[model samples]
Target: KEIVGVTRDITEQTKLQKALEEERDRALLYLQAAGVMLVALDQRGKITLINSKGCEMLGYSEEELIGQDWFNLCIPEEERDKVKMVFEKLMDGEELPYEYFENSILTKDGKRKIVAFHNVLLRNQEGTVTGVLSSGEDITERRTAEEALKRLNEELELRIAQRTEELEAFTYSVSHDLRAPLRAINGFAQALFEDCGEQLDEKGKGYLKRIQEGGTRMSQIIDALLNLSRISRGNLTLSEVNLAEIARSIMKEIMEQEPSRKVNFLCPPRLMAWADARLIQIALTNLLHNAWKFTSLKEEAVIEVGERKEGREKVFFVRDNGAGFDMRYVNKLFSPFQRLHKAVEFPGIGIGLATVQRIIAHHGGWIRAESTLNEGATFYFTLTKGG
Candidate 1:
């Protein structure tokens, strides 16, 4: 007990323990921090230190970055001279803490990283700029995500093309196989009504005639389905086209689709556009046919085709004074296989407007419809100026 009572100096040991504790805390922070990359450059702008986070941000190991000239290692060669100039400015007691957004940095992995930097100058006691301390942030992932999204959209378009081709093949098979049997039945029924009319009563003759008519109607639908498929699968050959000529041609086509109906087509002459003439003609034909079909109850049908300017864009409209539909169902108007009227009344497969929408999209444009029940309807589309 007497020996243990001897006095001892413990100051050095206590200080050493505190220093060790601080070092351990720093190591823990280095392990946990994912902050903006931290790097320090000496007065000559040589990298004196790059923390763990910095190495990870630039896809480099610590050993590769340390002792390397930070500017030469990361910046583009052309920009290195400017960086040296900036470093000289910093050493001359000038400082810059901010720069523009969306600058690029060459990463160790050979891929470019978009980065933004903020820096502070370290000073000595005599107020000399000794070095630079920088905090850099990486925006590569965001840029990569944007590029990937763009490619995904392109892939989606290609996939749609492939699917449409497959549907066309299926449609061909259905059109051929389905119409053949229907044609045979219709032919045999007509033959019975003509060549064997004396063997059947008036009711039997009426039954045969109804069978032929129903078969003929079904065959007409099959043919319409094929035409609708053609509209969707056709390739767009974009060029400068006159909308007035397209409208005139569409009026003629619609008249052919329904020869008995009287349709008044009004369109301006020499209206110009940048789109595929064939695709636009198809879209116009569909719209005009719809106008004529819906206006069968009216004695006079009025259809107008024209363009209007709207805020750095041009909108073209196909307006009709005919039977319209409810606004509540407008959302489904351009959807494939959706119809506002019954098959018996409208006599279509409901793919016409969908085809028109696809054509507009191919031209980097958009279309919308506005209508009210028992009133007139208008279909509007916009073709971008530079697409």
Candidate 2:
């Protein structure tokens, strides 16, 4: 009976041992499978345990890392003292300022990598602090990318500031230097026309008139250029703006200027958008004026200002029954000084659409035109919601 009892006891003991070994193996497997580096340090700052990821990151075998001084081996020479101090404080039962922190570690290849670590204190069953267990993620690549982006942003800001300064200088020259000569030319031509009218014949008077017209046209172009420059550089003040009201006001001004012309203008009762109010006013005015100008030759001129929903976006448009151009030239439509029609026919300096495009772009919006030659044209634009 005693021999049988001994054999049964041995068998049960063997089974219990096997079960403990299996549990340990499972725990080790989980640590090895962890994506981040898992490390455990003893009270003396020696590595007690390290996972496969920690071994791979340090370029060392588990055998080499185990029982090694963690701070002296893995930490960079410059940071070793600081890191060791923190470990000592933790061992002394001081709470760390942060449970999560970042530092640099030395690699086997003499390279340094940034690590973001989340650390916790390990304790014995007696409630005494034993060591620290840490899970660290190598953030070298991410930190490098973020630093590069910051540098690039700084460079871009510098370039923009320089460009703005240059633009201001150019604007000043145009406002003073160019306009001075232009005013002189127009003033002299007017004087010649008034004073020498009796001495001048029809042809001479016609020449003087043409000179005056040329000077006036130049002045208008200079003003347009200044406006374009101003639109390109400014802080945007976004607000809720009634686009329909602005369009109606612009049309009213156009009608008053040309009261003899009969035209049909249609605008919705209300069309609202979130954008820079002044900028939107400028854009709408240009679009409405273009519509009125293009449809002047038509006996039944029809111009409409309206809005519609395109998916989640609100699309506002100006439609006109006018002399539209070929679709092929649409690419050049928004370029400054690019005109599809002759100046005599269009009577514009061709900067209107370019200005409109800049204003739309500033609002984080886009504009497009659709047209069939002599049929009609519609200009559609969408503003970024909430500006």
- Model 2 lDDT on a 0 to 1 scale: 0.90
Query: How do the residues 228-303 of candidate 2 rate in per-residue lDDT, one tens digit apiece?
Result: 8888588889888899888888899999999999899999889988889899989988999999999999999999
Worst ten-residue run, lDDT, model 1? 96-105
The per-model lDDT (C-alpha) reads 0.80, 0.90
In terms of lDDT, model 1 sits at 0.80
Off by over 4 Å in 2: 1-58, 62-150, 232-234, 259-262, 310-312
Please report how far candidate 2 places residue 158 from its true position, in Å.
3.8
- Alpha-carbon error at 111 in model 2, in Å? 6.2
Clashing pairs in 2: none
Residues 107-164 of candidate 1: C-alpha lDDT, one tens digit per residue: 8876777776677888899887788777778877887898999999999989987997
TM-scores, each model vs. reference: 0.64, 0.63
Steric overlap count per candidate? 0, 0
Residue 254 Cα positional deviation in candidate 1, in Å, after optimal superposition: 6.2
